[model samples]
Target: MENARSGNAGKHKTRASIVEVAARLLHEQGTAAVTTRAVAQAAGMQAPTIYRFFEDKDALLDAVAQHVFTTYVAGKRLVEDSDDPVADLRAGWDAHIGFGLANAALFGLLTDPNRGTRSPAAAAGLEILRARVRRIAAIGRLRVTERRAVELIHAAGTGAVLTLLSSPPQDRDLGLADAMYEAVMRQILTDAPALPADGTTAATVAFRAIAPKLPMLTDAERTLLSEWLNRAGDDPASFDASHRRG
Candidate 1:
């Protein structure tokens, strides 16, 4: 048992070392420089040794991308939530834009449709955005459903990054990201948190956020409330028409 444990630990260490080395090559020299031979040479290992841990070059690149992105996501998660959830959301957006600009090569890999569609790291990032949007919804400030808010933010961020990256650094508009963020905010957020004391849309969005957690209700009641709130949140007109006859 001791020997088996030691062997597994050794394998983990070797794999991590290889991944770190590949990640460095990918960063310092871009994706094309991360071939198995280059990574093995950098790690001071035999090329065949890489095959023991990774199936192929693509597999190694995937692991490297995961490693690099996991570090970034961890940093994003470490930020403490402030009193203003809207501010927190804006901070997260800024952090994402900064990361994309700093890690251009990794960003390309992450945005590749072929790989991104199945990337756990990409999914993790999206989940973080959802959490941020959920907080805004809970505060009665979101004008849209949580899903729509997330999609709009994600699309805006991607477009902002790609547009900035396409330009020369000196020629790039420094205000583009902030402008895009403001545009998304205008589309998704209300005037202020709970400002209109009698606003239906804000209250409906807030209620939808907390409906499931209302302990006074049974599971069936909660489910029904959720469905109604979903309708109300997604389309207020449909919600009104559906209940008008009743």
Candidate 2:
């Protein structure tokens, strides 16, 4: 048992070492420089040894992405949440942009169409975003359902990063991200009015936040109510007409 435990630990260390070496190479030299031979040489291991841990270059890149993402998320977790949810959300947006800009290669690998959502790190980041959006809804400030708000914010943030990354650093518009955030905020949040102009929408948003917790309803019933609430939030008049018909 002791020998087997030692072997497992050694294997884990070797895998981590290879991933760390590949991550550094990807950061400094971009994805094209992360060949198995290059990573093995950097880690002081044979090329075949890398294959023992990773099946192919794609797998190695995935490991590198996971390593970079874990490091980034660890830093984010150390930062305490702000009392003001909106402020917290803004901080998250800035952090995300900084992470993407600083780790361009890893960001590119994580955002690749084939590998993007499949990354556990990417899913963790989305969960963080969702939590932030939920905080806003809990405060009765969100004008849309929590899910919709999360989607809008995620789409805007991803688009902003890709847009800025596409431009040369010297020519990139630093303000674009802030502007996009503001645009999404306008679309998804209520103003400082005592009551939103669209009361049904605000009610829908608020109710959708707690819809899942209603013990009176089954899962399917809650789902149907959530769908109705979403439709109401989007178009109260249409939702009302549909209900009247029903």
- Candidate-wise lDDT, in order: 0.87, 0.86
* Total backbone clashes of candidate 1, pairs 3 or more residues apart or in separate chains: 0
TM-scores of the candidates are: 0.94, 0.88
lDDT of 1 at 12: 98
Clashes found in each candidate (C-alpha, N, C closer than 3 A): 0, 0
Give me the candidate number with maximum TM-score.
Answer: 1
Q: Write the per-residue lDDT of candidate 1 for residues 153-208, one digit (tens) a residue.
A: 99999889989989988998969999999998999898877554554566788888
Question: How displaced is residue 233 in candidate 1, in Å?
Answer: 1.7
Query: Model 2 off-target regions past 4 Å?
Result: 193-197, 213-231, 238-246
User: RMSD of model 1, in Å?
Assistant: 1.6
Cα displacement (angstroms), candidate 2, residue 55, comes to 0.8
Q: For model 1, where is the 10-residue window of minimal lDDT?
A: 193-202
- Expressed as tens digits, the lDDT of each residue in 1-246 for candidate 2 is 999999999999999999999989998999999999999999998999999999999999988888889778778778888899889999999999988888888888887878887888788888888888877886678877777889999889888998999998999998999999999999988874216455677766777776777899988888889778878878988888888998
Query: What are the RMSD figures for all models against the true structure?
Result: 1.6, 2.5
